[model samples]
Target: MMLDDLSARPASVGLVAGWSFPATVFDPLVRQLPGDEVVAFDWSTFSSDWLGRGQEERAVPGLGPAVWVGWSLGGSLLLEAVRRGRIRPARLVLIQATPRFLAEDGWPGVSLGDWQGLRRAAGRQPVAAAAAFRRRFDLPNEPAPSAQLAATEGLDWLARLDLRSQLVSIEVPVDIWLAPDDPLVPVDWPKHLELPAHVHVHRFEQGGHAEWLDHAASLARSLVRPLADDPGARSAR
Candidate 1:
C-alpha cells in the first residue's frame, strides 16, 4: 500500500514484516541502506492475499525481482514466495527465519506448549490476551514467527501449498541471518531446512527476535550488509 506513493528508484528493497510486528521496526535498518530504501509491505494479511492470488500472480508492482528482506515469519515468507514463484527478487535476505515451525515428536525445535499456547491464547482469549501470548511466543528464544502469516483465509491457502522441493527452483541468491538466542523458532529448526546452493547464512551474536532492527546495529555492519561492500559476493558463492 505504501508503494503506491513511492516513486520508482533505480533499485529498492521490499519488506514484509512478521505477524503483528508492524513495519516501523525496519525504519532504522532500512534508513541505513543506500539510496532512499523502501521496505514496508502489508502485514501478514497481504501474504494471505498473495497465496490465493496464486503463484502465477504474486508479483506486486515494483516488486518484480526486487531485493526481498524480512524478519522471522517475514523471512520464511520471502523464501516461500520464491518457491511458489509468487514473486522474484534480485536478492533474498532473511533474519531469523526458518522453514518449518511445528515440531515433530523427535524434532528438538518447537514444543507443544509453544503451539498449543498460541491456539489457546488466540482462540480463547480476546485481543489483549492474544497480544500478551504473542509477545511471549515471539521472543527469539521461542521461534514462533513474530507474526503468524498463514492464519487467514488467503494465507491458509498458502500454507496448504507446500514447496520443499521447489526451493531449488528459485534462481536468485538467498541469504539467511539467524539469531542464536531466538524464542519462537526455538533451535534446530534451521538445521532441518534445505536451502538452495545460492543461499548464504550468517549467525548473529544477539538480537533474538528483531535482531538488526531492535537488537543492535553492530550486527548489521558485518552480518546483514555484506552486500553494501560488494553486492556480487553472494551470487559468486
Candidate 2:
C-alpha cells in the first residue's frame, strides 16, 4: 500500500519494544507510520507481579482489534498473549523475533552457555552488559536508560519461554519480518518450524536486529502494505 492509502484510513497501532529498551526506541519508525494512532508499551511499566503471572492471568492493557507490532522479546510476549486469549488483534507483526530463544535439540537458537553468561553479566554489571549487547547488534551505544530489574526479568523470560508448539494455533493473521544478518535471531527458523498458512514471512537482505533505527520509513511501509491488502484487517476496522 502506498503512503497515501495509509493516511486515508487511520487505524490503531500498538507497539511493543524489545528487551531492556523503552518505547521511545520506536520514535523514528512511528514518524514514518502516518495516520495511525500509536500506543507504546514500555518495559518499565511491567511490574514484577505482572511478569510472574501465568499466560491466562497476564494482562496487556490498551490492546484491542488493532495492528500489534512487537520486536524480539516483545514479540514472544505477544504470541503468548494471543495464545492464552489475553488480547485479540486484527493483525500481529513480529520483527526479528523467535518462538524459542534458547537452542533445543534440533532448533537453532542462542547457546545455553551464551545465554547464561549474558544473564550473569547483566546481573553483575547491567550498563556494561547492555553496552556490549548494543555493540554486538550494531545498535546505538546509549539509546535509553533501562530498568535493571525489569531487564533481568526479561532475560529470564528469554531463557525459559518456548512457544514453538503454540505458534500455529493463533487465529490472527501474522507477519514475521526477519533479516538473515540478524546476529540474535537465527535466519533458518522458517525452515525448522511449522507455521500456519495465514502467517506471512518477509526476509530482508540487510537490516540486522535494529532495522527500525536505519530503515524506519521502508519498515513502516512494509508493515502497512500487507494490511492494506488484507480484507479481514479492513473489515474488522
Candidate 3:
C-alpha cells in the first residue's frame, strides 16, 4: 500500500514506543519529520504508573487528531485507548505489532509458559534481563528504569490482552510496518486480521523487531507523506 498523495503534514504526530523502549529512542525519527508538531508517549512512564490506573491516568496532553505511530506493545495500547474513547487519531502507524500478544484464534504469538519464564527472569535479574532483551532486538541503548518497574505487569498484560476486534472496527487510514523475520510477532500476522479498507502494510526484507532503528529515514517518510492526503490534516492546515 503506497501513500502516493502528498500535500500538507498532520498538525501533530504522536510517537509511541514499544515496551521497555523509551520515547527518546524515537529522537532520530522525530528529527526526520521537521516542521510538524510532535509528541511522544513515553512507554517507560506509562508502563510504570498508568498501566491500569484508569482513563484519567492515560490522558496525554495535546494528543488528538494526530497520526499515532505506535510500535510493538505500544500499538496495542494505542488501539486500547481508541477503543475506550480516550483518543481519536487521524491515522495509525503500527510497527511490528499485533492485535493479540499471546497465541489465540490460530494466530501466531508468544506462549504463556515462555512469557512467564521471561517475566521470571526479569524478576530475578531485572537489569541484566532488560539489557539482554534490548540486545536481542539489536537495540543497544539501555532501557529506562521505569520500564523495569512494570515488567511483571506488562508481561501479564501482553499475555492476556486481545484487540483483534478493535482493530477491525477502526475506520481511519492505517499503516502497518513489519519485518518478515521478526521472532516475536510474525510478519503475516496483520494479513490475518480483518482490518479496515484503508489499512496499508509494508514489510521490510531485512531488519530486527526494532525496524525503526535501522529504517528511521524510510519510516519517517512513509509516516509523514500520508498526512498530506489526510482530510483532517488538510483542513487543519
Candidate 4:
C-alpha cells in the first residue's frame, strides 16, 4: 500500500509534539502526510498551566480513525492518554519514544541523577534549559515563549512517569521508530521493549533524537504504506 491507499482509508491524520516542542515542530513532516487533513496538537493551546495539571483537564480530542504520530515526550503522553482511555487511534507512529523514559531494572534510559539535573535546570532556568535541550537534539529552530514552562513541567513528568505496565493495554498497532545514534534515548533501548508481535520496530542507523524532523520526508514515505507492508525493510541498520 502507498500514500494514496492510506489517504483513502483515513480522512484525517494527527500530529503530536514532544515535550516543550509545539505543533509547528512537525510542519515539515505534515506536508508529507499523503493527501489527508492533518491535525497538529499544540500543547500550548491546552493551557499555560503546568502539563501535569493541564493535561488532565481535557481528553485528547478525537480525529476520527487515523494513524496518530508522536515523537519523544509527545509519544509518551499519547500512550498515557490511551491508557487513561482518553482516545483510541487506528494506528500509532512513535518516533524516538519509549514506554519508560527513566532507566530502571536494567533498562537503558536517562539516569536518575541526570534527570534530576534536567528537572532543576528546566524549572529554575527554563529559557537556558530549553536552549540546551534543543542544542542536544541539534534542533535549529527557536521555541515558543511558553516552551520553557512546558519543558520544565515535561522534565518533572519525565522524572516520575512510567508506562511499561501500560504497554499491554494499548490495543492500537504501533510503529516504533528508534534512532540508535540518539544521545538521549539509548541505542539499545529496543532490546528492553517487550512488545506484541504485531508491533513493528524500526531502527535507523544515522539519526539523532530529532530524527522524525530531520528525516521527515523519508519517515512519512515509509509510514504512509500499510503497517505490515514492509516489516523488516528498515528494522536493522
- Backbone clashes for every candidate come to 15, 0, 0, 0
Best prediction by lDDT: 2
Shift in Å, residue 10, candidate 1? 8.3
Q: Which window of 10 residues has the lowest lDDT sum in candidate 2? A: 228-237
**Candidate order, lDDT descending:** 2, 3, 4, 1
lDDT of 4 by residue, 81-100 (tens): 67765557777888888878
For candidate 3, report its TM-score. 0.81
Candidate 4 vs. truth: CA RMSD?
Answer: 3.9
Q: Worst 10-residue stretch by lDDT in candidate 1?
A: 149-158
TM-score of each: 0.69, 0.83, 0.81, 0.81
Q: List the residue pairs that clash in candidate 2.
A: none
Q: RMSD to native for every prediction? A: 6.6, 5.1, 6.1, 3.9
Candidate no. 4 TM-score: 0.81
Better of 2 and 4 by TM-score: 2
- How high a TM-score does candidate 2 get? 0.83
Positional deviation of 192 in candidate 2, in angstroms?
1.1
Residues 36-146, candidate 3, lDDT per residue (tens digit)? 477776665544434455655345545554778888888877777767666667777887888898876678887777777779877777666667777775764654545
- Give the Cα lDDT of each candidate: 0.54, 0.71, 0.68, 0.67
**How accurate locally is residue 170 in candidate 1, as Cα lDDT from 0 to 100?**
59
lDDT of 2 by residue, 75-139 (tens): 88778777666777778888789999999899898999988888888887777787777777787
Q: Model 2 off-target regions past 4 Å? A: 1-7, 34-36, 44-65, 227-237
